[model samples]
Target: MTELLLVATGLRKSYGQTAALDNADFSIRPGEVVAVMGPSGSGKSTLLHCLAGIVRPDGGQVRYRHRELSEMSDAERSALRRDEFGFVFQFGQLVPELTCVENVALPLRLNGVKRKEAERRATEWLDRLEVTEVSAKRPGEVSGGQGQRVAVARALVTGPRVVFADEPTGALDSLNGERVMELLTAAARDTRAAVVLVTHEARVAAYSDREVVVRDGRARDLEHAA
Candidate 1:
C-alpha cells in the first residue's frame, strides 16, 4: 500500500445543536484521489473542514502523517495547515490585483520562499495545468475556468502532502468542469499527493480513485475505480 498521508477515525463534529459529522472514518494514501459526495446538509464540508484543521472536531482523531493535528493547539494546527495541507474552494478566491503567477506563488512566498524562485515554481505547476499562457493575467482578466485553474496551480505550488478541494468545478460548465477534473486527478497521480475532493456530481466523482457518499452525517456507500 502507499504511505498513509492522512487518517481520521471516529471523526465527529457539531454546530451548536446540530451534528455535522457523526463518527466518520476516513483515510487517504499518498497518490490517492478520494472524492466525497453528499447532498447539502450532509456534513461533507464539515468533514473537510475538520480534516484541514480549519475547524475543531467534537471528537475523534485526525492525523496528518504522524502528527495528531486534532489535538494540537490552534497556533500549532495553523502552522501544520500552512505547511502540510493545500485548499481549493468553489471560487478561485484569487486576489484580482495580482497576476496569475503571483497568486500561484502566494503560499510559497508566505512560507518565506524568495519571490523569483516562487514564481519559477509557480510557472512550472501552471504549465503542468496548461495555464501558463495566462500567467501574467489577473484573476478578473481571465475566464472562470482559467481563474480556477490558477487556483489549482496555487494550491499545488506549495507541494502539500494533501489537497482538500470543495466543489472545485461547481462554477464551471460541463466542458470546463471536465477539464478541471482532469487537472485535479492528474495532479494527484503525478505529484503523489493525496486529494480529497467534495462534490455531488457523479461525473466529478468518476475522476477519483475512490468515492465515499456522505449521508446523515456519516459515510455510507462507497465506489472505487482506477
Candidate 2:
C-alpha cells in the first residue's frame, strides 16, 4: 500500500460548549481524492481545516509526511501551507481587482517566482482547466463556474502536494458543479496530488476514491469501517 501522506488521530476541537470534533481520525494517501462527506455543521470543514494546518486541534495530532502540525511553530506552519498545501473555498474567493490569470499566479509570486514565469504557468493552468477565455477577466466579470475554475487553477498552480477544498461546488448549479468536479479530480490525478474534499453532496463525493463520513462530531472512514 502507498504510505499515508497525511494522518490525524484522536482529534478534538470545541467552540465554547460545543464540540466541533470528537476524537476524529482521518488519513489520505498520495494521489488519492478522499471525500469528507456530511451534512452542514457536521465538522467536515473543521477536519479539513485541521488537516491543512489552518486551525489547530484542541487535542490529538495531525501528521503530514512525518511532520506534526501541532508541533510546528506558527511561521513554520504558514510556510508549510504555502509550500505544500493548496486551498479552494465555496465562494471561489478571488481578488476582484486582479485578472483571473493573476489570481492563479498569486501563490507562485508569493513563493518568489518571477512575474512572467508565474503568469506563464498560471495561463497554462487556466488553459488546462478550460477557462482560458476568462484569463484577462476579473473575478467579478466572469460567470460563477468560470470563477470557480479559476480558483481551481490557482490551487493547482503551486503544484502543492495536497489540496484542501471545502464545499468546492456548493455555490454552483448541478451542471457546473459536475464539470468542476470532473476537471478538479482529473487535474489532481494527473499531478498525483492528494485531495481532501469536504462536501455534503453525494454526487460530488462520487468523484472521490474513498469516502469518510462525518456525523455528530465523529468521522468514520467507510473504506476501513467494519
Candidate 3:
C-alpha cells in the first residue's frame, strides 16, 4: 500500500466575506501527483496554501506524517516549510541578482549546506532539468521556460517530501508548459516525492495521478464524482 504523506481534514478558510476553502479534505500519498483544478476564485490556490502551511486555515487540521500543523509553533511550521516542503509558483520567483545555480542552491544553503557542495548538487539538478547551459545566467537573462526550469531545480534540490506547485506553467506557452510539466512530474517520480499541483487547465491536470475539483470553496475528487 502506498503510504500517506499528508492529509488535510475539514479545512475552512475565508478572507472577510469571501470564502476561500470550505470543509475541504484532501490527501496525498508518497510519489503521487495530485492536481487541484477549479475556476478562478474557486479556492484551489487557497487549498494548496493551507495544506502547505503558508496560510493557516480558519479551522481545520493539516497533518504531515500525523503531526498536526495547527499544533506546531510558527517557527516550527516555518522550518518544516523550508526543510520538507518545496514550492513552485506561477512566477519562477528566482532572485534577479542570483545565477541559475545560485537560485537552485538557495534552499540547500538555507538548510546549512556548504556553498560549494550546494552548487555542485544544484549543477546536477540543472543538468537533469536540461538547463545547465543557463546555469551562469540570472533570472532576467534567461527565457521564461529556462527560468521555470531553474525554479524546478531549486524545488527539488532539497529532496523535499512534498512539492506544492501552484500554476507552475501558467506563464509559459503551451509547448513550454508541457515540457515543464513533464520535467516536474518526472523529477518528482524519480525522487519519490508527492506533488500537489494547482492548475485550471485540463492538459496540465492530465499529468496527475488523480484530480480534484474545487467549486464554491469545496473540493471533490473527480474520480469519485457521479
lDDT of 2 by residue, 56-173 (tens): 9999999999999989999999999999999899994899999999999999999999999999999999999999999999999999999999999999999999999999999999
User: Against the true structure, whose TM-score is highest?
Assistant: 2
Which residue pairs in candidate 3 collide? none
What TM-score would each prediction reach against the true structure?
0.94, 0.98, 0.97
Note each model's CA RMSD in angstroms: 2.4, 1.1, 1.6
lDDT score, residue 152, model 3?
92
- Say which candidate scores most in lDDT: 2
Which 10-residue span in candidate 2 carries the lowest summed lDDT? 217-226
Range of the 10 consecutive residues with the lowest summed lDDT in candidate 3: 217-226
lDDT of candidate model 3 versus the reference: 0.93
Candidate 1 lDDT tens digits, 82-187: 8878889999489889999999999999999999999999999899989989999989889999989999988888888889999999999999999988997888
Sorted on TM-score, highest at the top, how do the candidates line up?
2, 3, 1
Evaluated at residue 127, the lDDT of candidate 3 is 98
Q: Candidate 2: how large is its RMSD?
A: 1.1
Query: Local distance difference test, per candidate?
Result: 0.87, 0.93, 0.93
